[model samples]
Target: MTDIDAPEADVKRAGDEGLDARLVVDRGPFRLDVSLTAAPGDVVALLGPNGAGKTTALRALAGLVPLTDGHLRLDGASLERTAPESRPVGVVFQDYLLFPHLSALDNVAFGPRCQGASRAEARERAAAWLDRMGLADHAHAKPRRLSGGQAQRVALARALATRPRLLLLDEPLAALDARTRLEVRAQLRRHLAEFEAVAVLVTHDPLDAMVLADRLVVVEHGRVVQEGAPSDIARHPRTDYIAQLVGLNLYRGQADGHTVRLDAGPSITTTEDLSGPVFVAFPPAAVTLFRDRPTGASARNLWRCEVEGLETHGDQIRAVLTGELPLAADLTTVAAAELDLHPGAAVWATVKATQTHAYPA
Candidate 1:
């Protein structure tokens, strides 16, 4: 069976779990097309750069964007042509978009009320959802009265109160401050873990996607470039974008035993035993820079490089170097000032063989 079938089989055994979609959406000037599937209780993240159509795919599944072709199946039923309100789908937009004038309880009750529940029944269900989301105290508060994190939770409760079979979140944590994001992300992860339905979230933050989703579908130019578990994708990135996203320096090479001959003009000695086309990856922090090429160092990879640029990130300075091999080196401000490092400075970069990891391409 294909990778797609493997997950579907797991979902069938899990009972009312998962969604399968083959979506094709065409705008006047752009077309987005992709196939995706996730098992019940699975949180799949759609990750990509700006204009990569991550949002478009989410919108298509939510019935907000019409599909030019393809199918959407939840559990076992076809929902390709279903209307947004008619489908068993729940959506939490980037801004949360809660009704500022309504109490949190009423906002959560909106969906069930629209679904034909009695006012009393809807309010009861909404109260239960608010309690579950840890917002019981805030139920009577207006959206404007809640903090960013609290507002996010209310939006989540509103979506869950509808009892959707599939939940869609568009940049769920994008609007929060850094501190709020951390707290909300942890809360969201807990909720997603407890959710029995299939949940798909669209995000540009790698950390958010990695921590929140069981698997990731990476898109570029409106097509899927890679899709797999977060750990797998992080270890074996297939494209430069994925490499950069995960903060690794990747190079294609030909390997024999412990030595890999890189196409970019260097030979790296690694501990991995691999053959044929391979990839070598290391972090910028693993690289050590010297004012002059060393003779007695045990490092297997060493190259003379000219500093191209230097920039500060947090407490560390990242030095961009170009030579036989282009590399990024992270150094302390004290070390940088001591070395008098600046753009156009010539330096030697060295890395131990054990610091480099090689895998089949």
Candidate 2:
């Protein structure tokens, strides 16, 4: 399990710097090839669908999984052949993975003990970490006696107790209940902010990625499809998967000046000036629905669509439409009822050119 392609010749790499890695892992039919970098004090999130190799990439950095190719440099040294336990790395897994038989403090102290600290010294360090995580009172409690949030905090405390230069968290909040997740997520955010180290978190939850990381790297089928500041990625998703995750209607097309002709046989005018292959996107709420096509509508981008389905989403009704262009539209229940929207009902969908954003593909 500790096998590596080749060990770096020198051990001069500093632990306090940052992380720069290009990980490539091949597992029969699957292959993960992604490059990631994070500065000290920066938290980067790896987000994608299931089986997207997010956890594999994290493991490769931790040395639990071997890299088929590529290199991993932390701060300024190479960890291409470092063992998992020897690497200056810590991991908080999705399940928290606290020893059921051990007390919270003992669990947190275990890492320091493994690193050669005296029993008393390890306990002292563990106490400080638990106190920092607001779990000083639960230090004596076993993992079974702790609540979900408490156990999560203990796991984080254990990981941070190791004083790793590069910390890895895989679905850090996935084990908690909805209510506990909210509380733990906030607490975890604070802890991550205080850590002056390179932190990489893997999560499928968009909210978690948005709230926890300074930047997001989106993986798809073992490849990095997008990487950017959270806000930029949210506003301008380059792929359909990203657009769907961000709740937008996206269409690929060819752009000429302010007009783009969709590959689906519809043309949309956008305010952006772009050419060649492009993507035109807009919010579901930007779409206006009408029972019938209106003459001389101010919105020039129009499509005659048939309502494929309808469902209540929060305070709005989300309608799936299929026709000249396939897309989802969000309308208030009142408006939907007024238009008698239902499956098979014909409707006109319109969006203002100003509301649509077009970018090069």
Q: TM per model? A: 0.93, 0.94
Give the alpha-carbon lDDT of every model. 0.89, 0.90
On residues 1-361, what C-alpha lDDT tens digit does candidate 2 reach at each position?
A: 1111011112223555688999999999999999998888889999999999999999999998999999999988899988889998989999999999999999999999999999998999888888877889999999999999999999988988887888999999998899999999999888888777789999999999999999999999999999999999998898888998999999888999999988887799999999999988999999999988878889979999999999988799999999988889999998999999999999999999999988888
Best by TM-score: 2
Task: List residue ranges in candidate 1 displaced over 4 A.
Answer: 1-17
Q: List the residue pairs that clash in candidate 2.
A: 13-77, 18-75
> Per-residue lDDT for 62 in model 2?
92
User: Model 1, 186-235: lDDT tens per residue?
Assistant: 99998888777789999999999999999999999889999999999999
Q: Which residue window of length 10 is worst by lDDT in model 1?
A: 1-10
Query: What C-alpha RMSD separates each model from the true structure?
Result: 4.8, 5.6
